[model samples]
Target: MTQLSLRNQLVTVFGGSGFIGRYVVQKLAQQGARVRVAIRRPEEGLFLKPMGAVGQIDIVQANIRMPMSVQAAVKGADIVINCVGILHEGGAQKFAAVQARGAEVIALCAKEAGVKKMVHLSAIGADAASGSRYAQSKAAGEAGVRRHMPQATIIRPSVVFGPEDDFFNRFAALAAFAPALPLVDGGHTKLQPVYAGDVGAAVVQAALDDAAAGQTYELGGPKVYSMKEIMQLTLDTIHKKRLLVPVPGFALKPLAFALELQPLFAPPITRDQIELLKADNVVTEGAKGLKDLGVSQPTPVEGVIETYLYRYRRGGGKFEPRFS
Candidate 1:
């Protein structure tokens, strides 16, 4: 479908200050949409203002956990986008509360407001039967959206990567400091990392096209890489050669439990995350994906990862390649 003008359309993007949300907000801004970035802290998303004209973008304080706040955010918007999700359960942000119930609140509010288009962002491994709480909550969120607004567009993107992403950069940071990087479950779990921008484009496209209504699009990248391969690729990008140590998922369980017992900076890997890697995170065969929405070939990881990972090289940014 050809892109339609979003010049005067009001789009309320929940979690618009996040990594993927920032890209989505920028894409919507590019389409000349008046974006209402509804996040918990309006001040945090101040950076998004420059993406659009003087008054084209606005950030209002709203948390989906609170239905009244979400209702107000979607009240006058023409379209609503929910990208709010949490990897770990923090104080008041449990997986069921935030990912599942929060999604329900947003969808209900959008429906009540009579929003024309609603785009809900989910993950590829969102299955209710999955052992992982993250995946189960995501699946519940999808069900919530469908129940509230039958026509809402659902996008299940496989591991998104970009400059500001956690997947590549986290592994790269590990390579820079750690002598050896652990390959959980022998790093056999397959992942198709879709570029954050490509996801943003697909998301904005869904919002603009009427054909996307009542559809679910599975977005993936150009190629698939194993978990170990991804770690190796990150090390290669950062000009490092760290030993890839094979670590079984079961061995990490006790450590994850101990860390959860006592607070630290951030747990290296949560138990739920470990459960998630047990299954391949890729687009399923016959599932509607990027190409189905006019994105013939999504951007590859190499195109964007090296640009930022280079910062983690042994030397500074201008350092010559060690083994290019």
Candidate 2:
């Protein structure tokens, strides 16, 4: 283990129970930091206790929507990390409220608490002028953080994947069941699928490094792949033989928009999300990414999928050799 001591330093991680948050908490805990995971419902984060030494982690109920709760969570924190985001809108959890205003609220509270460092998790496509609501909200969140803490570090990652990721696994599973999987706009859009663990480590590195202050980093994997290539990789990993059917955006976008209306139930597709897929989700032009983050080339999907996707095979395991 690296001997950089963060012992007794308090870090309040918003949405630390999430897939990416778990990895960040693990890294910080190993470094001997006292981590406080702030979630809307603290009970949901109890599983995080096992990731750290006894009494090293704390779970607190804090909804970003509420100023008082956010303020309470920021109390005694040396550093604050915001991982809160939503792909779809919900009651009281709209994009503007959670991603934009909620970020401002958290930054304000962290500043009031005299926190020394702050990190905001954003997407690679975060642009104030973006057509997608998700992209726009991410940019707004970054602006919100900068407004309160000018020295805060903002990290923008391409699609993050891991064992429990919602990206590859979801599509791979559909490939197993369905005859063909639809590729948005002929799968032309490109993406650099960085591992979730890599993103987590990058967050930790930024928090500990003074030079990273007031800077924005775009994190991506070593190589870039088209959306079609990602789907093909998923198929190969799962040992599933399937054809990728490209759907014209003009034909499918309307249906997706209608499907997103029922936010009450998890929507298969949303108009905003469909629009997002139209743009390449790779890293920015001249941003320092894995090289500066102290991480070697990020883990590729090819090596990771074989480890996790085996469970989804025909026999619920890897393919066994057949006797002649």
Candidate 3:
């Protein structure tokens, strides 16, 4: 057993209602921290209460776009974590507004409130000079945090997957029903899919480790898999076979932009999301990861897919026979 630490600390987690946020909140609660989940809608975060002991968790409304609310959330907290990011944009929720400006809000408020520590979650492909608005906003968000909280630990994780993840399971479900699955750029884009639980554990480790201050960690799984390989693995795990149709970047990219226009109804794709796939979403060379965060080796995609993807299988659960 590891030495118990960070007992009784107050932590404010922005966007704690999200897929990754729930896991991180639970891990923090297990360490005896008083976790305050800050979300735009507190009711949605009510599910987090069961993860902790009585009075160990609370939920409050704190929209990053509203600096005053963010300030109120950070006030009197020992640690603050920013998980507010958007995969696709909508009204008042563009990549720049939420990812870039909102990140700055949390950092600045935390600094003003004298919060002892902070952690920012960013994607793996963050680059200031990148063409994708998503990547650029992430890079900008990191810069904003550093500007205010120079010692904040920034974590850039590759594609995160788990029971609630929309990555592998969503694609697997689609593959189960669709006649053919499109392989963007011949599905050559490399990725290192990390488990959401592992990433959450990394957050707990970083928030408590003073030595991790001001450092950046790039997290990935034990093995790297290409887009096509991941898709195939998804199919194999769900016991479905489908044709892999290669879609050239030139032809498929324009459609991606058209998908971006979907935010008007539902953001099927954003210009930034399309641009993000042009490059591999994996860890950089020699970057600190799970090992540095003191998390055990993350579960590989192969080991985890069946646990959740079973629901999407044709017969129902993994135990259900195909012909039955």
Candidate 4:
């Protein structure tokens, strides 16, 4: 996509203000696409205006949960990308409404509006029969997308990590005060964490390339690390040596329940999250991944963690590395 010419295309990005969504918008802008960032809060995404030339990017209000909103957003789109999956369910944003049903709305509206192509952001664990409702809903969403737009590109990325990511950053913040971090079910569950930027590039590729149509790409990083390994890496990066308690999966239910009862914005953990960690979150064998899409050799966790995690160090970014 060098020369990255997409100036003639109009890309409507749902949830474009989110972590992965923002990166997608930036990459599309790089490709010279006229981007319409569809978000719940259009004003909040005002900062993205500078990502492209004047009048090249616009913000629109849209909620995937509402069919009319989704219809309005994709009315004249050349490409539509749905990066709107949720990890937790609370209040009015249930898994069924937002993930499963909402996905169907997007696909239906896109089809009716005659969009050229679409890309849906799903996770590696999406399964309809899975114990985790979050994963099950995601599977439903994929089914809906396939039903409406068979050629739509679906991307199932393993754990995604970057500066503003929720995984390592959340644990790093926890380590700032907590004496110890829990290793649910002995931390054997594995995760191959891919970089957010890489995923963004993949979405952009799906948008511009007709060959990417009717594809499902499972994206992961170069190495896969177990939950404990990830926790250890987090501790090391932040110059902390907190104890990693080997708590059985069953024991965390009570704690997760209590944590879930906390204010939604400040939740420490949720029961559904515990269920998700029960299984490994890695790319499945024989599946098409980043390499298949020509996004070769994705960035490793070690290569980028130190760049943003230094803020969690005892004395901050310039502080000397501490060894335990």
Candidate 5:
């Protein structure tokens, strides 16, 4: 099979300014593809221009909730990737509107615009019957995408970690100030933490490989670790000895709710997030993953976490002696 060439191809990525989306845009730019970053605010995405040569990357204002704007974003693009997703609901950004309906709108717009291929980013725990509204919304979004573009490649990734990721970075920052870290539900929930860059590479592969059409890939790292182990790893990396306290779901709901009410851009933890932690976020056994999508060796958390996490260590970890 002849692989598609991304050189000079116009690829539009919705939410291209986000944590995961930036990596996708960078990968596409590296492939010599002309990247159109569709974001809510053009100014917010202007930083992406340096990822490519002058004029190779263009930032356009787009909101998936607005069909006309989505149409404008998909117009004249050979491929489209939807990376727009939210962890929690906020004003005008509900799970249903952004993840579910927003995905459908993009898929439908791409189909109408005569796009050659499409890729959709989804989460591992997306399920219609799941208790978490976040999961249910993600499942709905996948369904909507399939309904509109049957040949679209859907990539479901487990907990993704990187320099800008919230998982490890959040806990590591917490340990700097707090003496202990709360292990929700004893932190028993297992997760296969795939690197953000690998997932981005997988998305690019799915776009270029014809066989990936109509396929679903679950991306995970080389190893799976429980939530407790993940927290311990953070402490170990930052040279901190913080207590891992086990807190049940019922006990944390009140606090989660209060946090949600705060005006912070991203609350420390939300009620829906607590519900999401109930289920394991690992890739299924024997499921297709990063290897199948051309990412031969997905990155492990320990391999790259210290690059950004060292700042949280005491005295910035500069004066501390290296501990074996």
Candidate 6:
């Protein structure tokens, strides 16, 4: 597909300061697109300014739950992207509120503003019939986008790993102090981990490629692995030898509930997250994917995890033996 030029185009990105959103913003900035990062706190997203030339990237305060804020952000923008999503609900940031309703608001506002193009970030496991609320909400968000803007592009990724990702980083952190890592449901759940950078590239391509409009792409790596294998890989990368204990999903619910009750910013695991683990989180067979969007070879977990997981290694990964 021929890539559309984004030079000098005003693009509004909701949640531009987030893990996956940052990558999208950076790529847009590189393409010379003027980025307006619509975040709840403009000060928190000020760090994104360095990704582009002076005045190339700007931040505006906007909340997805607030229609007026979303409307103000998309005004006069050539394109819009919604990257706002929550892993676990917290207070008013419920899954239905942020993922479902928040998405509807963005799409509605972008359509009202006469935005030509839009790209929405979703997950591969999104299903309306799924037992997990997170997955259900994701499906609802996709439906909302389609309902509001029929031409918008949607990209669904599975287990995105990056330098600041919570997946590998969270498990590695647990291995640092804990004696063992719990493998929910015997760790048999399958997953195809995709790199955040690759997903970001897909998002950019979906935004610029006219062929991608009104299409949904499932993004994943070249290989698939079970939950047990993922945990073992984490241990290998970080040079840790923690036990991999197989635990039933039901057994973990009590502990997950306890974690949910805590006041910590991000709990180790929540009950809702355990429900998410009940099913495999891999791309469906014959689904449109990264390769369809020009990312023929998605980066594997082994290629990127070590870049950041090294910090979790003993001695800060400075004393590794070199055998050549």
Best by lDDT: 5
For each candidate in turn, the TM-score is 0.95, 0.93, 0.93, 0.95, 0.96, 0.96
lDDT of 3 by residue, 80-191 (tens): 9998888777678888989999999899999999987899999899999898888999999999999999999999999999887778866876776789888877899999
Global Cα lDDT for candidate 2:
0.86
Candidate 3 collision pairs? none
Backbone clash pairs for candidate 5 read: none
Model 6 accuracy (lDDT, Cα): 0.91
- What is the TM-score of candidate 4? 0.95
**Pairing residues by index, what is the TM-score of model 2?**
0.93
Candidate 2's displacement at residue 311, Å, is 2.4
Give the higher-TM-score candidate: 1 or 6: 6
Better structure of 4 and 5 per lDDT:
5
- Model 2 lDDT per residue over 1-324, tens place: 222347788999998988788888988898889999999988999988988999999999999989999999999998999988887886788999999999999999999999979989988999889988988999999999999999998999999988777788787777778898888889999999998888999999888887888889999987899999998888887788888989987788777767767555566667787889878999878888877878887888786767777777788864442110
Name the 10 consecutive residues with the lowest summed lDDT in model 2: 315-324
lDDT of 1 by residue, 1-324 (tens): 644679899999999999889888998999989999999989899988988999999999999888899999998999999989887887898999999999999999998988878999999999999999999999999999999999999999999988777788788876777899888889999999998888888888899888899999999999999998898888888888889988999998898887776765566678899899999999999999998776887898998888778888867475332110
| Model 4 C-alpha lDDT per residue in residues 1-324, reported as the tens digit of each score | 322357768999998888898889888888789999988889999988888899988999998877888899999998899999777877788998888999989999999999868999999999998889999999999999999999999999999998878888899999999999999989999999999988998888877667778889899999999999999999999899899999987888998888777774756667888889988899989998887666887989998889889899988765342210
Show pairs that collide, candidate 4.
Answer: none
* Per-candidate count of clashing residue pairs (backbone under 3 Å): 0, 0, 0, 0, 0, 0
The segments of candidate 5 whose C-alpha lies over 4 angstroms from its true place after superposition are: 317-324
Model 5 lDDT per residue over 106-163, tens place: 9999999999799999999999999899999999999999999999999999998888
lDDT per residue (tens digit) for residues 201-261 in model 6:
8898888899999999998899999999999999999999998999998999999898888
Enumerate residue pairs that collide in model 6: none
Task: Tell me the spans in candidate 2 whose CA falls farther than 4 Å from its real position.
Answer: 1-4, 262-265, 317-324
State each model's C-alpha RMSD to the native.
3.3, 4.4, 3.8, 3.7, 3.3, 3.3
